[model samples]
Target: MAGIRFSQLIDNFITTIERYGSTVLQPEISSSRPANIRVITSEQVTDCKIFLWTITPGGGGPGVRPESERRIQMTNISGMPLWPGVRTLLGGWSQEFGVYAFWDARRHTKFSFRSPSLQVDANTLETAGTTGIATQFRPTKEGEEVVVAVAPGSLLWYVQNGLPLHNSQDDAAFVVDLAAASPEEERNFLDSAQSEIESARRYDLVETMRAFRDASFRPAVLQAYSYKCAVCNCDLKLVDAAHIVPITHPTSTDEVTNGIALCRLHHGAYDNALLGVKSDCQIVINPNMTNRLHEIGLDSGLEEFKSRLPDVIRVPASIEARPTPDRLRLGLKLRGWPEEQIA
Candidate 1:
């Protein structure tokens, strides 16, 4: 699925409200239907039924402002009292509210509370169940008590350390940012994995949640490096969290220290054993890299890094989180680099 950001959601919400003139409906995270902004139009009665188009904007009648408009008409053909929830879902209530609601003309009063649509189409409702809210991607801890609010389908924000920050910001942008440190630091993969494993075991499930495992590890590694490639210091937001120790080894667990954020090119180089890190946290390109690249006419890509061989990497903040000296030695040993104590 395509990634959606908080800014885009807010912009879409504002645009929908402006275009429709009055009220529009959007899905909540728990909404049964897939998220969509539905415009409420003017009421019209045809034959024995009242037709209201929630899909098309400005087709039925003049849209009413959600913040102020109220005292709506149309009790349907039977003229019976409509459920308050229905009115809320339809964006009928006009009174100022943090949620959606509308007024009832026949009842001569504004209804209280917000309501999301409960439609159950296969592509919509079913699909929504299979996915998460667009803004909330990674897993979070329970009992952490972080205040979060979604502006219906349009936007999402969380209050962290007494400051509000939107998820729309680049993931790297949040790492090490003092204002968001508490929240970002809280996203530890080991903790998340343990939590998920416990949750799954509670249900007696045997299969390991590989997807969940990968999801937890990747973000933890990326955040630790503040989403920048530790080798090149590139902050292009295309970095990958690479494992220092191959998972085939028993000690290769998904710990923050066991991973490094690397760009695609460097990741490939490391995997191919063309690149190695020393116990002193220095990066070393293979001595034969220049000759090899020259033979293949691919020198431009890694020429700079090769020229600057034996450079220091951007070490993580925590000393323990830096690549393990043993792992670095092992990495070079596996690559047949003639270095026993260091790469």
Candidate 2:
């Protein structure tokens, strides 16, 4: 089958990102060799650039080009030819790309790019390298692998009929420094990337995202709560980040305000709907659970659990990090609390 146009792929890429609620400000496409897609999130351009390359199916899994073919030919800032002795001002350059493969009959899947260091060819006035993409900007320990979903898409009709032609000519390399991006900008990028991945409906990727999300969420919530359980103030290293709104809910979010740190016992109770937290941060026990405590063999422990809980759950000193009242209410409602009691 004939390959999709490079322009069409770019359009699809932009469309996919925008579908996740990110705005791609005027993308500046270069009119010369070494295609560029410049996404400007702010008025002032920064020094960070992220180069992206697309990997398509090959005889041996997804194939990456040789370093020589992937090199970025140097260009002046004005989009003019580089003259001798004219140096480029680009800094903090990193390369990333998506690896796409056919998952099943209907969909295509992509995985996160590996982190690779860029090698500058001074004599040739070009830059390129072959390395793995990091899942995030943070320094990962040596030999540790962090895999997350990059994006996935439904196969086009023509692509479903046969192997789509692989065209390296369509690859557009661009760069952005996520470490320097504002929180909102970072969230936008994550949201878009996650949306793309989820669309594939692959079980492994879904589970991976869930685990990754919780792994990332735990530290943020634990720090906000001083590494202690909000209900009982247990400071042992047994605390976990429990989502106020259950993860299965459509409206659930990973925001700190939507999470609370709790020890294993309280976390289990909260998830089971036997324990609830009001909008005012008051700890409440379900009367139905208490009435039937003996039947569940928790009659003796239930009283002790109630005694240990504070009048109000310990909250973060930062108001922004505190649990949102609306989310708390919704959480309680989801846990089968009566509307009157939830308020």
Candidate 3:
């Protein structure tokens, strides 16, 4: 219960700023205990700070640097890691606030930092499920919190805090979302632990085709074969996520047609755009590079590769006309080739 209150207290402190509007100074812990324990348990907390600023900028402010056009200043600052919890708060509401330490009407600077303790609200103790510890990864109570690096899909910041310091300037960014810190933090942690795992998983079949030019050809081939790659025979390892689709293209998934089981070398050739597969499953070396077929000085370094493709075994009796064929054809067009070369 003491831990829960501690979490709740943090929420309330932020709320206090929203309601009455005051600079919040976290209490210094001469000594402390969990909210309900009522016993004094002493501890040490390394340095922790929270710098608040707007989410989306409005117009401009005075500065030697390029001022954000937002009515709010970039409040240029440095030395703060962007926190997810803080982002949630600003994204949710606090962003539009005209009340802040920078406002001329405010008496005290709206910023304060001190020791961090898990002392909950005296009444309703929070932070219950947490394990206490001050690991830079998590502000937990007792157990380990997995640490993770931000993913590419992850937004670095809606607005940044690495700005110049001034009474009116906003700077220093911190993790924004705290209420659900554990889950998100753990997600990041899992990513960190499984970085190699995800990378390996991404190397599955369809991507094998992507290594070649007109990357879509592999998918079209897979889709025609229902993702099985007739020549090499591969399938999605599990079902939750499927194998090859354009990284961000709208259409991609676990369908057999989307899978292609190219051998290791073929997969490499496809992704780097070194080789291209035809709509008819023929190999089309970049014409300008009289080198695709001669890399090893053997007129046949990769000549036998086409026959090794899954397409050789089945050739889709009726020739299903490779769905919407446009994407791959567009890719072909991107290479500036004429119909004769592709067909």
Q: lDDT: which candidate is best? A: 2
**Model 3: residues with Cα > 4 Å off, grouped in runs:** 1-138, 142-261, 272-275, 280-300, 306-323, 333-339
* lDDT, model 1: 0.42
Lowest summed lDDT window (length 10), candidate 3:
35-44
What are the per-model C-alpha RMSD values against the true structure? 17.3, 19.3, 20.7
- Per-residue lDDT over 1-343 for candidate 3, one digit per residue giving the tens place of the 0 to 100 score: 0122224433533443222111233454222221111111011112223333332332234563233322222232322333332321111112232222221112112223332111111111011112111012222343322111111111111111111111111101112122123334534533543456543432221222122112223334444555443335554311011123443444543333444444345455554444555555555555544354466564454556544544333334334433234444444445455556655
Instruction: Give per-residue lDDT, candidate 3, residue 338.
Output: 54
lDDT tens readout by residue for model 1, 1-343: 2222334433444353333222344443322211234443222111111111122111234654222212222222222333332321121211122222111122312323332121111222122223311111222221111111222221111000111112112221222222222222333422343455443332221111222233346666877888778888776544777888876565566778778888777787887778878878888767665577779897775756677544778988977777788887776666566554343
Candidates 1 and 3, the one with greater lDDT: 1
Pairs with backbone N, CA or C atoms under 3 Å apart (clashes), candidate 1 = 9-154, 22-64, 42-61, 92-102, 92-103, 93-101, 93-102, 93-103
TM-score of each: 0.41, 0.45, 0.27
After superposition, the stretches of candidate 2 with alpha carbons farther than 4 Å from their true spots are 1-201
- lDDT values of the candidates? 0.42, 0.47, 0.30
Backbone clash count for every predicted candidate, in the order shown:
8, 10, 56
Write one digit per residue (lDDT tens) for candidate 2, span 5-122: 4445455644543332223443466432223433221111221122222332222233463343212222222232332322111112212323222111111111123332222222
Point out the higher-scoring one by TM-score: 1 or 2: 2
